[model samples]
Target: MMYKMQFPKIVLIIIITSTLAVNEIRFYPVEAIPDIKKVPEEYPTIQAAINAASPGDTIIVTHGTYNENLLVNKSISIIGENPATTIIDGGQRGNAINVVSSGVVISGFTIQNGTGGLPYSGISVSGCNFVVINNTVLRENYYGLQLTNSNNSQIFNNVIMNNMYAGIYIHDRCSNNAFFENTIKNNIVGVWSSNSPSNVFYHNNFINNTNQLQAFPPMILDNGSEGNYWSDCIGSDIDLDGVGDAPFAGDRYPLMGMFVNFTLRYGSQIYFLSIICNSTISNFHFDRSNGKISFDVLGSKDTVGFCRMASPLTIIKNYTVYINDKVPIYIGNWTVSNYIYGYFLYLHESEPQRVTVMLDLPKNENPQSLFPILVATLLIVTALTIIILIKRKGKLDKNLS
Candidate 1:
């Protein structure tokens, strides 16, 4: 009928519509209960409990022997009450715990006696991410823990021992894994990795196993091993700083020939005398002058007076030369019957008369007693004869005038 409504009635109608809209949308209280889905303890098996649980559920295993293989098909937390008491026996068939899905936590349990005829393991993790295996004991399996095509896994503080193949086998594109503070011992290979890279293995004691460690040889050729400890090193810490004095060249097959030859001949005493003589002889120098060769020994004591030459003097051999009072020079090569010590100077010339050689002795030494005294005595006699003749001629001229 196109009739106008009052202002108060319009405001009242708006308020009623807003209230209806608010009431139409459901409102629950702040302290409301979540959709709790409980897993019963009477499920009689861990697998039955897992089937009934959803994605974000925890399957708790009580203290008993669950002699069944577990396959985690979804993201779930499988916790055991006490690892030392909870046993997941594989009945000598497939893997005891196979995680096919990601984000799974399998902690605090003893996984043992698992067997697959062709190289299966106690726990086989495939294509999984963010998986944690902690405080777990894996023993007596073909492989303790086999990680294949997995990434970003944490394996810490676990004891993996007495396995058939390898204690920890990371294979086929597994990377970014942390293997820390674990006791891995008594296996065929403690840790085996084929073509895996960028992995951290630190602060782990690898002790007294049959084969403590091994890696793919070809992969090591491309990616080198850095900062690893070997239990078989026998070398000195020369600098007293805990590192080796020489670089530890690892078990490279190509260098075995050189190492064998070096070890066999390195400590032999055949060259001992030669090494000593070479060290002594390198300290002296030789020079020749005026039909006389002089040896200017830099640090020889003044007790050196005469020099002696000894033999088979093939330039420098056991060519012992001595210095006492006079310098002895040899013109030609000679073999001596006796051994002489100290410096011996030698000069060689075809015409010995063309050069004169003189030996200057120390001032304290008496030239009269030295063997070269003959030449000095002859010069004094010639001077006395010339002086007597000159005085006699002067007296004869005075008498004749």
Candidate 2:
């Protein structure tokens, strides 16, 4: 670590002030220099856009039904205008979108109608790394997602249901892949993995499936803090921490409630964290200015509500929980994963209650919470000095006369 005395005072102050400045979150979007290719507007088809686009370009598909099987061979981002109306049907043919390139991001689309077979899916990946598939819908396909020899990929925030075979099929030594925050419902099998080892699965809801897993590989069902929520889980949360006691299949710490994920952007970096709550969590706010992460939790008056938080280690090193502006009697914490895990319970009412997580960053790095107080003290000192100077000048004028 570098010493602070070696740096200038003004530079350090600027860094701290701007790092957690009020109302500055999500302001500086990284505007890349890549060419943006619009579908049907610039190329008339998505395939045409890919054919003409260079690597690192972005293809934006507007709101409409597009009947085409896309094969992406270059590193690019394909974003739909909206997942509900941006439909990409494969006409009962091959895969809806086959990705042979790494660093690919496909989001906000409803991909369906692929041929009913293994390796043919709404989104198929082969030998790719750093690929992200999120904010999309995959239904009525042979496999909602198929990953072959893919590693370091993230699959989250997608409604993948009613598939013919499995919602996700992974094989051929797929390792280090993360599957989280997805709703895999009404499928023949939720996930089928063979010859794939060391793949992590968490924060996904497995509901109403004939078979949840038909596996031949070693998988981590939990992130050491909490696991995915299974509708048919036999385990129970005895300690009221929103985590199950016994193991369900392979998840030792299954979440009692559905996992909710939030994407927060500060400056150029994006931060991701998840919450497992019995209440309807909304109005989530991350105020680094005051070192408080606040949110509104709502539920019926008859039910008791609780929220389990999985805070990223990069965001805050420690935190305190406050419910409705009062500190609760008990708050549970887990020393499991690299991230900070904590939870608290509250009595539900007609109005939504506010919960806040007062953050404590690492030593000397978090220059927040005290900055405002220091500014106020500086203003007071300046005002007192001005008043004394004015009185002294008046007395000096009288003495001169």
Best by the TM-score measure: 2
- Kindly give the stretch of ten consecutive residues in candidate 2 with the minimal lDDT sum: 1-10
> TM-score for each prediction?
0.48, 0.70
lDDT of each: 0.55, 0.84
Q: In candidate 1, which residue pairs clash?
A: 305-324, 305-325, 306-323, 306-324, 306-325, 307-322, 321-342, 321-343, 322-342
For model 2, how does the per-residue alpha-carbon lDDT over 1-401 read when each residue is reduced to its tens digit?
13224334534455555454433456667776799999989889999999998899999999999999999999999999999999999878889999999999999999998774444798899999999999999998899999999999999899999989999999998989999889999999999999987999988988888998888955889887678888788666778778888888878888787788877664445777678887878899887567678899888895767787776787667769998889865687765557777878778889988898887754544467568667655655655665566568768877999
The TM-score of candidate 2 is 0.70
Q: Tens-digit lDDT track for model 1 on 1-401?
A: 11123433544555555455334566776763322222236578877777676776677777778888888887777777777988889878878888898888777788887787778788999998888888788888888999999888888767788888898888888877777556677888888887676566643435445776666632221112112233444444332222334433232211100000000011121111110010012122222221122223222332212222222212223332333333345322333343212223333222221112232212332334443345444444554554565457657766886
Flag regions of model 2 displaced more than 4 Å.
1-34, 116-119, 265-270, 280-301, 312-341, 347-401
